[model samples]
Target: MRVTRRRPEWRVTAIARDTYALEQKSPYAQCVDYLLVGRDRAAVIDTGLASRGALRSVVTALTDRPVDVWLTHGHADHIGHAGEFGAAYLHEADRPVQAAHSDPAFLKRLLREEMGAALAAVARPVVRRVTAIPPADYRWFGDDQVFDLGGREVTVVPVPGHTPGSVCYLDQATGGLFTGDSCCDWGVLLHLEFCLPPAVYLESARRLLGLQRAGAFRFNWPGHHGFPAAADLPEQYAACAESIADGSGVVRPRRHHAVVRYRDVLITLPRTYLAQPVGRR
Candidate 1:
């Protein structure tokens, strides 16, 4: 897999296809969006970021399928550009944020001051202005929500703690989970804002562990860079959460794009557990 970092967005390419993300440089990385392609129709997992036009271009280049967008949460960066799409979907709890995307100026101010200035300069000469996708375009996700994307399917799993309505999209056909910042390589560790207490995040992490143990997924595509495969990450996350819950886990601060090494820390409860079964506890 190749990760391409554009001016304010990141594009991940796999299997000769691509997924887009927006991460303007800031103390806190705002939001990360993804565009999942299919033969007939395309699904964009998140849309609020600096890459609204880029996201649209990538989707169009991949396929002419009617695009469907869903947000992991309703943060400004995750829902801002959603208005450009014909239809956008997000959790019911995030509808207000999505509705706010209709107002371009409001959305612009929400961006980091520097990013807003850059964005303004780009939009001045652009022929089209940002528009809003109608409310009818939204889809509310309940538990076990299923989206049929022709041959492949995306299951909406409520991954709270990060946000009241935050979710992860699991593509059964690919064994990949589109984790929207539920986990990431970024250095910012502000759990208080995006999620509940550390315990809530831990439970969410444990839930992902159960799915990994069940062989539900193999690849983990997080909203941010440096994601791990299910076979490599699930057990580790579980172990970390277990340790944290018991006051035995030590979270070593790592760099923004540091390469994670298993030996640096214990590989107790992640998807790696499935990879090396002979050493199982």
Candidate 2:
């Protein structure tokens, strides 16, 4: 039963000076993609999901300057239209598995994990309709690497826990950190097969905490729900990961996995738990 309906528009906003955000509210969760307009050219950060359709036309309406695409990580939701914009920069560490994350079976399992049994019956069919992950011209970079977008610069700070090549972009001009699946106040899953252990994740959290403490950035601009999340999410998440790493956090069973909570944040652990082999840092 295909329910035909209107396609949702990208909720556009000027998140910062010369920086625009196009947000897609997916059936299961919300996703955001950003466009940063620099003096010479513009860069699109992450591409949301393919369901949102091609973004180049939308971006062209925003700026006439040449454009570049950058992926914060390789998650299906984040890199959906990456190939639509030509070659994009992603950390080499994520190159191995990033391309295969968008297949229908993977999305089905992921939606099941996120939406749970309640919606699985109605959602699986929708997931199955998704086309294969598009092939991309990928240019990989490493941590602390800076991309000069003419006048402005964005540095990639690798956070491996979410995915081995997961990173947060520190926008030099506005002091905003474009953190993708990482450092979200909603829920952070460290249980994926490609994710690093809690101990490794904690290190990334600590780095964010330190960057926050030093005023490296003003807000944590996540790829999901809620823009500029609570000021102390990094701190709380650090403690949560720490508790899990040390086995002191109270863990509760949740469907296929368990979760450890710190305040309003929940860090889901893999069923294999801490026994999963560590990935490259």
Candidate 3:
């Protein structure tokens, strides 16, 4: 069978009234950023990895209101174009990762490791563009910070597991919860050096579940390819993590490491980390 790939480009889709999903596809990664316009100012979530300042043009065409950049986490793919915008805001816990990624050397090292030599060679220009525009300054914010954009309010919910500072933005006006890589349809990655253990991640998932039960938000917009995840995704993710925490899930090898799969969610971790007694919820 022949394989086909989606051409990488910058496209915008209106997800809701006054809200748009700016999707950027590349050979390296597919990133879905968001733009929320309010009565006064507008907010951009998770600027996609676009070199040449294409994202700025997209946002400008969407709304002329003052814009603020808010990061879901410090991942390179998410914050690559953040420098084009003014000061960006992120959780303090992720500052280290964000700072490290801002360095050209560190990003190059990461590309070499994650993409390997052949792929990295092809992805070098994209990587350079990603790191070219480093944010002038990153404003640190904590959990539960409410950003009021005139009539719309977005509450920051800390969902630390994908990354120490990973968070979901709950839009009070639209009932949309923007979850970066914290939870997704493809799979939630928990194997990186900066990622938390499955047990700890379960807590964050449970918290989201609590919000879901309380009618806090209606839908989820994941960071990557999948958008508007099913409402029960948090519950399902929590259950998967629970099994992993208790050593009940079957382990399978993937890319030289073991992972526990639960439905659409995959929990990847080092064997030693999985054997640790901590974070057994």
The candidate scoring highest on TM-score is 3
The digit string of per-residue lDDT tens for model 2 on 54-145 reads 67778888998888888989887787777777678899889755755756676677777766888888455445434644566789898868
Candidate 1, residue 144: the lDDT equals 68
Cα-lDDT of candidate 2: 0.80
Better of 2 and 3 by lDDT: 3
Model 3 residue 220 distance off true place after TM-score fit, in angstroms? 0.5
Model 1: what TM-score? 0.64
Against the unseen true structure, what C-alpha lDDT does each candidate score? 0.55, 0.80, 0.82
Candidate 1 wrongly placed segments (more than 4 Å): 1-12, 16-32, 51-54, 95-137, 186-190, 227-231, 249-281
Model 2 regions more than 4 Å off? 1-8, 109-118, 121-134, 274-281
Q: How does each model score on TM-score?
A: 0.64, 0.88, 0.91
Error of 2 at 94 (Å): 1.0
RMSD of 3: 3.9
Cα lDDT of model 1 by residue, 29-104, tens digit: 3445566666667777776444334556655765677888877776655654565566666777655544554456
Best candidate, lDDT-wise?
3
